[model samples]
Target chain A: MTIEIIIQAIISGLLMGFIYALIAAGLSLIFGLMGIVNFAHGEHLMLSMFSSFWLWTLLGLDPIISIPITMLILAISGILTHYLLIRYILKAKMIVQICATFGLSVFLRSLAQFLWTPDFRNVGNPLLEGRLEIAGIFIGQPQFYASLVCLLSFLLLYLFVNKSETGLALQATAQDRKAAETLGINSNKMFALGWALGLSCVSIAGTMMSNFFFIFPDVGVHFALFAFVAVALGGFGSIIGCLIAGIIIGLVESLGGLLIDPSYKLLYVFLIYLIVVIYRPQGLFGR
Target chain B: MNNNLQKAKLEPVWHTNKFIFALIFFLVTLFFFFPFINPSNFQLHLMIMIFMYAVMAQSWNVIAGFSGQISLGHVIFFGIGGYTSSFFYVEYGITPWIGIFIGILFSSLVAIAIGIPMLRLTGHYFAIATLLIGFSFQIIFQRWDLIGAASGLWIPLNWDNPWLTLQFHESKIPYYYIFLIFFLLSYFSIWIIYRSKIGFKLRAIRDDPQAASSLGIPVAKYKIIAFVISAIIMSPMGSLFAQYILVIEPERMFDIEISIIVLLIAVMGGVGNVWGPLIGTIILIPLSEYTRIFFGGTGGSVDLIIYGILIMLICIFRPSGLISFFPKKILERKKFL
Candidate 1:
């Protein structure tokens, strides 16, 4: 109710929103271009988190530095996933694609559980341990750094997509694969690039989350649902829409939790999702 | 009606079938009632759990399998039923039997409202929408202190007075039989619907909604109707399960996991095919129970991995589900396929 409390909530919401946007941007891009809802999208993020945790524990690397490593690894993993599994379902029905990806999600989650033993692991990053005090509001140093990283990533992504040839091809494929093929673009390569880029987004978000958030096998399910809600809120397939929607949802969660229990935060956001889908199936920013 | 008679005659004979559903049913029923035939309390408890699961799966199959909506929030209806019956039982001493009807009514009404909005969404959106509604219901239930909130409410476990709304005796055999009857009735109701005109509309919509709509079928109306009818059957499932478990917690009644299990079974069995869920339950339920027994708490999602693999195989190889495993001659002869 007070200005300080509101300011603190807004700060928290904006930071969380950036993280949501970072993770969801890839999902939006892949879904837009491929018309496949990658249920394993969050699993990619989970893998990054685990990798970051291990890197931190073993080599004493900061999560921020581990970000690039995770992104590169995930990019390769994403391409391989598409080449091996998702490529076959490109021409198949949407339900088939959905189930295929959902299967991959389960498989990846099980693999993580088998490997990690379901223990919560943290990235040992000293930078992440610091906090900032601004006008009576305390914000974690890692979160602020993550926010800056998210903004920079978004800007860099925007440039790559808008100013680069491969990005143009990816956009063209997303707009219409058949048309993009007519332009002598290798649509498969474009799809692979899109997939890799999507995973990179997940990697960055995962690294950011691992700094503070505990890494677990099923964490992807939680974030994936929230990302879906964000995508739905923003209008599916719209990057700008996802950005806006992610912020709105982040505010909704942080502020709504003040009125109700935190456990019901997702439930309330889902209600918004239902209402949005019911009223505008195309989403707020979807075309 | 004419087609109904033809389909009725097309029922696969128990002897001709390799699965022997009738024998299995009888054996399972007898096993559940074996305690009553002799008298053992612990074995009877397991029977009650099995019966509850059987009925729960049946209710889920109606919408997820029959209507092909693929809802992941069926536990919402179960929660509605449980809370409705529990609230009335505790406050007014109303028998849960009567309270069950009120539960069904409330559940159906809410389902229609949600369905009316969600039926527009296809595939994953529909699934997510239902999940949201289920989650919302859980939140509301947990927050409303009248229903005991997070602490949960305990219904009196009286045995002697059978006339009371909810009670249990020395033996759990009667509960098992009662659930068996409910399961049979649920199966029969779905069967009848499958053979009915409405069932045809539902299947047509599931196969191809645009084509069905083009053929003058009221697609939206039928989908909502299917949800309503499914809720009517499923709500009582909650009441029965709550009574059997001797308690109803919000999370247990409206668990997201329950919805996933239901969808997983239906998808594994061969969605849109009658007896698919039953067959799936027969195969997978026992395996799951065994996993629980073997690994205890250690086995987090080993079974889920198996189920996920099965779903992938089915979606890739045989989207028609286990029903495709039946012999060609039987499928051709029945013509009910």
Candidate 2:
């Protein structure tokens, strides 16, 4: 109805987009490295939120302060996932690869419900709890901060993957695992590193998200769905593509929810994804 | 090639000695007489479920297993099947028999529309697209008011005309027999398909679409055909299942769990094989149902956790499935037949 409302929605959507991109970055990185689309990526996000919530409650740590700890926790789980399950099914059929992660998702979702009792929980009083108005547009402090932090994390990940020697080795593995191995790079270590980096990226986003979003067992499902779309739409293995795609999805979701019925916002996003996949199988920015 | 085709037709794969005939007759007889044994209501319910899922899984198998296009969100058709027939039966006072045919027709058209675009994308792209489509349909059905909205449709009990309504009020016997007949017919049809050229061509498509296409098989057309066939196989069951339960909710109809369970059943029994879905359902469905009955399925997702673990383990350790455990000679059809 008003320009101010549209701007307000855009700002908030952009903020959420950064978080979505970070989540999609994890999925993209995993798929890029070993061609496995971690279906449990959503649960990893759920666990991270839970970890952040518990840290805030028990240790009185702000989500900002607890970001490192949560990242470490999720990174360790990512490694465990690789070493325990993924390493075995790397060369298995696509359905097996899918089912393994899908199974992990179901397991983690149920485990969370079993452990924390499926009740919606949230950070009681975050250190950052306010909104700021800029040029006739309002932005929540939590969302703005989360967006900034997510952007910062994304920059770091981009740097780590593009500039660092290990990062390039990880790239090398992704491009050609056998060639990378022949060149004396430990493809396995790079793979494990890929998972670690990937999950840690999401953990940061998840922690930031917990500051504002509801913390629940099934909270990750919608986010994970968005991440999957982002990963696919960005071309399965492109990190930068996921970032751009994530932002596009966020905008689409916000604008679509504004223009269309709010309930069908996600439907529009999926429609976009379907159109893209059907028309352009290589994705918008395929590697 | 010509001779092989003729031989296949002349000597169908299932022909065997009288001993096999007697065994088949005995098993059919036993299945028919199951309700007479005064079994627990739960047992009867379990059998009906097994039969129902066998149909669902095998239908899933036609596309996912044989065609090699893993559709993770396959329950969309099931939801479509259930909702369409239930809507007509409840609103127009029409018999479900006619409604079932309409459902099949409607779902086939839907599968065609979806499959043409969707089947063009292979492997993970196809799988995830179908998954999203499925979830999208669930969201739509949950909000759409015409088909009874989110709360779902409850078919009124037709005490006077149970047969016409496809609702059996007094006993589960009718549902069991009806589903058993369906299950057998479904299996028989699939068995025929598996032995026919279409079956071999589907298997070829499953193994490698590019190679199959190179060999002059119409890969895309065949994939769509398999996709529609799979949807057709799953369609009628929705009507029957809605009738059996007497309650059809969008949430219940299009649950991702149904899609996953169907996949788990197909994969665990052995993918790309006719016997696979039934075998998987036989072993896994009962275990799952019993777990729900024993462990309070009310409070938490204890069942999902189990299913997840079972699927993961099956994928990891026994990727070929449980059917592989049987001696090759019994289940394995002859090569070059």
Task: Report the lDDT tens digits of candidate 1 across residue range B1-337.
Answer: 7895565557543323444556657876776557656655654555555555655666666676656676767888888888888878878888998989999999999888888878878877886677667777777787778889876778876666764655666556667677777777777677677766798788888888899999999999998998888888888878877777767788888887677677666666766677777767766676666666677667767777776777777776776668779886765443333
Q: How does each model score on lDDT? A: 0.78, 0.88
Candidate 2, after superposition: displacement of residue A266 in Å?
Answer: 0.6
User: Model 2 in CAPRI terms: which quality?
Assistant: medium
Tell me, by lDDT, which candidate is best: 2
TM-score of each: 0.89, 0.97
In angstroms, give how far residue A252 of model 2 lies from its true place.
0.5
Supply the DockQ value of model 2. Answer: 0.80
Over 4 Å off, model 2: B1-9, B17-23, B335-337
What DockQ, between 0 and 1, does each candidate earn? 0.52, 0.80
Candidate 1, which CAPRI tier? medium
Q: After superposition, how far is residue B61 of candidate 1 from its true place, in Å?
A: 3.8
- Kindly list the per-residue Cα lDDT of model 1 for residues A1-287, writing each as its tens digit: 68887778888988988888877888888888888878787788899988888888888888888888989999999999888777877886555676678778877887788667888767654566878898689999888888778877977887898889888888898888899899999999988998999899889988888888988887887788888888777777788887888788888888788756677788778878877888888889888
